[model samples]
Target: MPQNIYVDSYTLESLSNDQNVCNACRHLYIKWKNENSELSSILDHFKNDMYELMNVQVQTEDSPRLTTEENPTLITTTNHQVVKLQLNAASSFHTKCCVCVENLRDHAAKITSQNRDFIFFSRNIWIPEGARCCSGHLINQLLLKEAVDQIKPFSIRYQELSSSDVQLLLNKAQNFVENGKKIFSFDDPRDLNDDEYRLLTRVSRDNFNDFVQTSSTIRPSCSRSIRTAVGIYLCKLRLGFGYVTHQYVIGRHTTAIARELMCGGDSTDTTIIIIDRTHLHIQKSRNNKFERKTFNLCKKRSLLKSMMIITTIGYVVACIGSFMFNFNNNDAGITKDILLRNTSNILSWLKEHDILAVDRGFRDSICVMEALGLEATIPSFLDGRRQFSAEEANESRCITKIRWVVEVANRCLKQFKYFANTIQNSSLVYLESDVNCLRSHQSLSTTYDKI
Candidate 1:
């Protein structure tokens, strides 16, 4: 055997099957004792001391470690070798071996009746977590893992382990459950009031005029011109009053006050455009054959699409650029035709590289604008087969940070009962009410930064 190899030949070649190693050690010890009585006497004394040390450390009954001191050099290299063997044996699978080559069932009488249990009280014990030793030797539970599930034989009470030592054993078996010493809460305990939160969600109307004038598109016109038609339409939608009642209120004919307000006018001087879209439900004319697509994501039912452009600052709606009826279909769908024709601006504004803050739905519109030399800023796309790369995800987050205001603007339009519902009108009638919602919201302002 090499210097590092400690186990005797009988133990190693046993195939770990019904193994019995201690008999050979005793036989070797007896051989030495017969050869030299003085050395045997000293070794016998040392053996007793080793058993006492193991008894203090381990919880098991049979300290096969009892005979580690059988070596003649118990005072020098022998003691160290025994201790090293004990530690190594404790950590390895042999620590739990309770199998006997013969019958140790009868040997159970060797220990006192109070400590009568044999090391292998139950043979063939399965160990999923730690060693599956047959258990005739001193075992080390400290060396066992805390994670794997393991089986233990009932030789436990034999070692004379105290309550504290038992606790250590049980703790190793427990695999470490959380003690739950810390507390968790959903809301902040020190939070004062929701007033600030409410104010932050809405924009104020004090600076409403500036926002509108700066943001409004070139007045789209019609038979009544864009402004005249829009004003009359708003009066009707705002109150939900009949066209007759609204006509009396605004001095207009009920016949002329139709739902669709056409924009036959021209685009004018305008900058800083914030464009948004809304669904307008219309009574299906011509046998009601208009196949309206459903959009559950935005929670709106519509046969028509209304794209409105506003200034960055206020409620001024510059243009109701397109009233697209074809949705989710081929042939450019809603944004098929470019918006520049409906919008009034310096053609040079496109060359000036004006940037428009838009929503994800208008993502297609960005390419249209880019073709005409304009820039658009929109949120990033997070949904796809693979995850977004770091740079793409960061850019998407940045875009959403700036795009929330457009969402707020859409919510403001939805507040109106008329604009909020599906419209029965086939024309651009509701355009005025939707555009004027900015000015009407003046009553809703507290500070200029109410948004």
Candidate 2:
């Protein structure tokens, strides 16, 4: 008569029904039954109540599943929910167009003929006339206005043409006009040499003097021997040549050329110097021992021996050659040299107090200016570090503004065809030198007049 110890009331009921149960639970139940047989009947009743509670269920009736056609409204409701969710997501993520600053999709929708034409003529799209951009962008109104203003003069000139001039021009105009097409011909004129026609056909005013000097029957020799020196100095200044090139072309050595340009008499008002540099490649020499050899052995044997020796020599030479010829080798000390030579005079000319605005390439030159009691301004290098100081940032902007003048000067100098392309002949050396002097003088004179 063992009393059952029930871990759960359900286990007790299973045991009473003679159903198999876990050994651990059954063992515990048997021990309790032996210890307390009176409690076994109470446990059995408790088990019956627990089983009834666990097994209790409410009545549920099955409903028929709805078919697609029978529940059309439900289908539409689900579709609408999905569409709404997508629309909300899209609206949340919508971004403005970079060019127009308008909603990109809305802009896109307005790109049709009716909408596009209205915006195009109204100039409301805020884009350049020829510019292609989405609707939302604010057109570059200032840039468009500037461009139109620039071409406005030409347009006015076109409109100002007399009816007779227009008719004459129209008659001369080429048939079948297409994009990027140009027509150039002498206009119909009563006089054989009209001033306009001559001006059109003749060399430009800037180049007129140079052209005349080159083609003139009378060679304009220097009035004085000193004039030749002056001319040569001006030429060197204008044609941005080094001591070597100037010496070779001017029939003077490097020291002479340097002295004449640097220490010579005061640079004339007409003196224009354009200074720039180019790398000159120097080749490594072959081994003397390998280059000369006595031929005494068999042809094949000698050839093999020579090849081995030559290959070894070639490898060594190439290594040395690369080390010597590499641009980095020359670039190392060049900035220092240029700064020392050029900036000294330039700073002195600026009266040692005026700002020396220069580009990034002239960073080292700034140090030279500092030594000369001059302040140099240049753009800050974008080295991916912290922001530049206010002073440094302003200096950069100032330098950029002034640097445009130098750019214009360079462009003007390049207008000379001789300097526009690479110098090919010895004559170009003199021509280049002259051009530099002329440009420097022009720029200095212009600057001085402004001051």
Candidate 3:
């Protein structure tokens, strides 16, 4: 490059003579030189900026991004982006197991398409094609439960995918969700087998379907269908306490033990019912009177009492009262009140000489039962004696042996966490209906199990 400065004759003459240029020309040259230096610096800076912008653009293009439209199956939870891959369904050659990454042993089975779907859909793990696993990890060609748990992604790889590959992945994911694994799904008829339905909900598949149909009036919510609501109810009932029924609690004459309990002159076919009271702890009420009424002296807690009537065979006949554990709600008082009120048609159901086996707590009910021509067989109390006499002990043993069934029946109900836990006051409104429903389930389930 060459620099050219045009000047008038006078300026040129002054320059040729090497004399100081005129002040006006000198100032003009200095200004021009400063402007050139600034322009050159600006150009260099612009070149460097352009280089940096180009480098950034290249890096951005190479990095994987989490765009729903571009990478539907890409999962970027942290710093590293995860690309989901599908296992090769048709590959029959594998030198090592995909799960454990161990050397291939004898009986290494090729991963089936179903197994791959199960792993990918459930475990969110992609098994590579031509992969095999030990036969022990499979059950009937499906991944064993333990093996499925062990299948986890250990390493990541950068995958270069085309548009077609991304489309294929989206299609595969949609298909797996629509037709693959489901856990206890009741909406689809084929999702679960009959036995599975029975095991989970304690109802046969046909019965469950029928129940769903019967409950069609159940309103569906946005989150669940009517069938799902019914299924959840049944499952909750099965999970909670199953109740006992009335007729099953009445003693059957066919049993040998029932005959043994009968007196010499008493008829062999006598109706015997075992009765007891079970305690359910409750939260202390805010009201002083209410809290005081519910406080139990024996347990030293606020409690409610339910009268359990059962049979010698350990079947619950009815659960009643669930009354406050007050002075007026003792076993004897509750029994007397039930008879006086003829609750559950006790007076109608009882005949002369019909036996009621109860613990000593029912001593006050003996006269009431006698007046009604019913025999209230209560365990003998020692009174002021240090111990029971031999005769009283023997008599008490007989009553206790039969009374223990009611205890066992109560235990069964309490086995469910719902009843075992303290009852909230708000739940009392539904307690009776819930108890009745439970009784029906318990009776039916027991009958079925016996068969």
Candidate 4:
């Protein structure tokens, strides 16, 4: 028998502190603790209940087991043991063609037996590759033979010709031939009619004589005329016009034509002078040892030969050795040549009120911008150690927002598919000119009124 434990005010806290308190008493105390006006008064009531429950020995009944019904098994008959199975059975045949309903193995075998050139297999049926019959007709050997005969010639031709040669021939065939009987003859100036001559004259007016003089003086191997070549080259630069495309447009070897145009007098107003060296992609060649000396040691080596090439914009600019040098590392060098050149050009071209926005890529370009008497605005670099001041953050955001206009302008210029898709080819001289012309025209047409 259990002793009667009456819980008094003091006994409650004492019993609560004990680790060995029974689960039923613990649960009863928790439920009674919240109901009392005074917790001390209810503690005694809970104690009496616990004592009563403890005194009585309660018995519990066990849970009953669940019953489950089993399913009936299916019986199947094999084709080989038909005599042992029931005589009466459901039909196995289906309304759809067995060749169409079953796997494609039977269809492929049937097609192969007919000696067809190719068979289209779908839904386990072999249809001639080009067949267009309704479901009403069954597969026939004679129809398959006719389809095979029709497809075999094309298949043989496809197998015999290489894809590259076929494409090349197709391209050659598509070109617009001028005169059906006459081949292209470069020697005879008389080949051009009066209208053609006038068109050439109109196009070549700016640099015709200059290019002619240059080509006459230079050896045939090195000859290029600026006047005739410049218009074509300008067409190339302004349009991202390709060599072959330029040949079609202006009738010249785009590469040779461009080189000739570049040889002309350098002071073209259309040339764009770049002040930052970081933007140019320089070509590296080990065979040209002198290129290394010119580019790598351009600053120190005064005797290094440099060429002054005229840009499409008609700016006479020196092609410094530094711009041609290939740097071994990714770190963009702060070369003085481009900065100095850009400074001079900007001072001449821009006014004090003009705003010049630049990216972090042109950190060095800011010096030139300031020297040219223009306002230079660039976003401040955020160092992780400290947060930006509110004013600085606002100013940076403003500059960034406005600077997007130039990026959009660049994107618009690249909208010409040739420039966006192809790398600037060897005929880049003419291509660049063509692109510049188109850009200049576009700028004049769209923004001239605003300016």
Candidate 5:
């Protein structure tokens, strides 16, 4: 023990009576007595006294009205040990808004975990649970940039954090940095203006808000918020990504809808379905058999054909059978295969006297359609003649008018680059599903222009 050391009367009295001392002094005493540690109780007591002295000074120098309110305890750390904070500003309480410092009994906008994270990432402030802010300061439960800028620690505050807390903060920081690299941020209205939202999502801000509200049941995942998930979906649709989902399937009621739309047409009680074949170019496969099978003699290229069945109103009924470009898989043969296979229950949907209006390529399937109690309307082929006679010309022109919608439907499907550009052999497996899903979208959507 050092000479000329002074001890406070409270500590001396406690020691003389062997009463419980302060935690720091008690810990030091235990270490010294049990293990002959070099730590001294007097020094421990001295540090505690200094911390109390600082608290006293802060209380005296600050506003007198502070005495009326409960003093908030702030936990701090020093030299890897827990210690009391000696800050000048009053720490915020759970019952008050940290931004305006107003007491909120109820009707407060509690700071959400996401808003708390954003505040920490932007301002290095850790808002405790149950802390709140004025609702005006937040847009979509996210702090505005101005609100984030306005936030500051009343004074320097050191917080003692465990390893898990440190790890959580690190993860938030990493996510913040990762999110910063995004070109468009939909969660923060400040990050994306109204016009920007409309440009990217093809919806105005108010409409987007309504969409988010309506889709609130789409629960947020660990990696994304509900708003962000909805925004991603909209962005994907607007950009023509057309990601496949469970809802992309052709529903059973699709035929009924097609029948309804095709009924009551001019001068004919028979249901009319326009059929056309569109070819998608593909790379010449390395395999000799596949390359030959996909070679189109007319276009002199490797190609794959998809048969489109659509309504007169340009609503695609079904996109089926991405067949090879070989003669056996010509438009007419593909039509016959569809009819024979009864794909999508085509036979059940078509009634007797139903009209299948198609171009010249489907002439071979005319007999198959007639046998199925269906009528196949094809334009008159030139057949070694320069042009059609007067009666043939008028009839062919009439058929052309009805057949034009299928061509427009094909063009609309090709608007997506996945169908318009040359496809790789690796993507052949997804061709049928992809085409059906895209056409299904066209059928369900009323936004697209109709011919």
Candidate 6:
């Protein structure tokens, strides 16, 4: 938006409210208040609300207290003989104010008489990423700006926290420990933004359980609930982070860490079950080099090597097993070979006469399917002859309509940037989500893969 905004009390009110002020528009309020605080009353309200956010107790109960409005910075505004924090400062004052004795939540609890166990840590306790109790204090940007002004300019040194202090941070953040339940307040699941809804639809609690059972590989387990951890992972993926190592650096929602743990370590263990392939002209990556990589002669787009596989889902079963690799040549007749490899169990999973919607690429696989006493619905082939008759054309159209969901399903995988972008290795495979449960129809999401 334009830099010169209409700054009125109403604008301030909207920008500062939790329900109305989204992350994107917050900077607008901050910038405006910094320039014209006289015109913005709601800015004060916002700052007040941030201060009220719960944090730890003070060690020195009798010491004088410093209010956020009067003293926002950790350091004193006056030259207070260089307020320097040492290596053990965080550990020593784990329950004291970041700036003074009165800032701790524990101290606040004593005053208010609340019994919730409060834990506080700070980014400034030591080096960046060091965990120290700012004496149960945190600073919103406004208070931080004020605090920095109070401290001597360029007169500070950083001290790293000890291992014990760091462990305190781990105890608070690590998945094995219990956490506050991440609240889900969706009145209607559709109310969720596209990615959030798609995420839930794709990997419901049922799907996660199925993953635990069916995978050939053993997945690492976490201490948190499945829903919360999955939510964190989805939130992270939606944010476009590409590495597992970033977990240590990124600050995820507290509610999310548990399930995010379920989506742990690496994408290598993931296996995408392409229930049906060849229904659409799939997009291939110009970058990655993995098994199913192929090129589209018609569209001339770089095909990120991709795949399609069979699964038993009259309506989305848990992903049991996966067949990741596909024909190097798109026209190759390997679908039948893959099925032959798993004839016994998979065939039993399929009900009698279950229809397999496929594209012409699987033409060669049809005989094997029929031979195995199953039904297949594929588009009519021109077969180097004349165009299909009217009846044949209608049948092809119907088949395409039914099978397009597979294309949408693959697109769903690409919603994650790790799958959409070319990676250093093909070892990172796509994850198969609950397919039929979601409406994989083309128009389901407008910007589903834009990120």
Q: How good is model 6 by TM-score?
A: 0.37
Alpha carbon lDDT of each predicted model: 0.37, 0.32, 0.61, 0.32, 0.63, 0.36
Better of 1 and 5 by lDDT: 5
Task: Specify the highest-TM-score model's number.
Answer: 3
Order of models, best TM-score first: 3, 5, 6, 1, 4, 2
Residue 85 alpha-carbon offset, candidate 2, angstroms: 87
- Please give the RMSD of candidate 5 to the true structure: 20.1
The CA lDDT at 170 in model 3 is: 35
Candidate 6: list runs displaced more than 4 Å: 1-41, 44-275, 278-332, 384-386, 429-451
- Model 5: lDDT to the true structure: 0.63
Model 5 spans > 4 angstroms off: 1-269, 383-386, 443-451
Q: Report the C-alpha lDDT of model 1 over 309-417, residue by residue, as the tens digit.
A: 4333333333243354544632234443535553333242333344565667777667777776666766677676467788767655654543345455666767767
Superior by lDDT: candidate 1 or candidate 3? 3
- CA-only RMSD, every prediction: 29.7, 33.2, 23.8, 30.7, 20.1, 19.1
- Give the TM-scores of the predictions, in the order they appear: 0.34, 0.27, 0.51, 0.29, 0.47, 0.37
Best candidate per lDDT, number?
5
Report clash pairs, candidate 5.
none
Q: Cα deviation in Å at residue 141, candidate 4?
A: 60
Q: What is the lDDT of residue 72 in candidate 3?
A: 41
- The total of clashing pairs for model 2 equals 26
Model 3 scores a C-alpha lDDT of 0.61
Q: Going through the candidates in order, what is the number of backbone clashes in each?
A: 42, 26, 3, 33, 0, 22
- lDDT per residue as tens, model 6, 18-45: 2234555567546644654432432232
Better of 2 and 3 by lDDT: 3
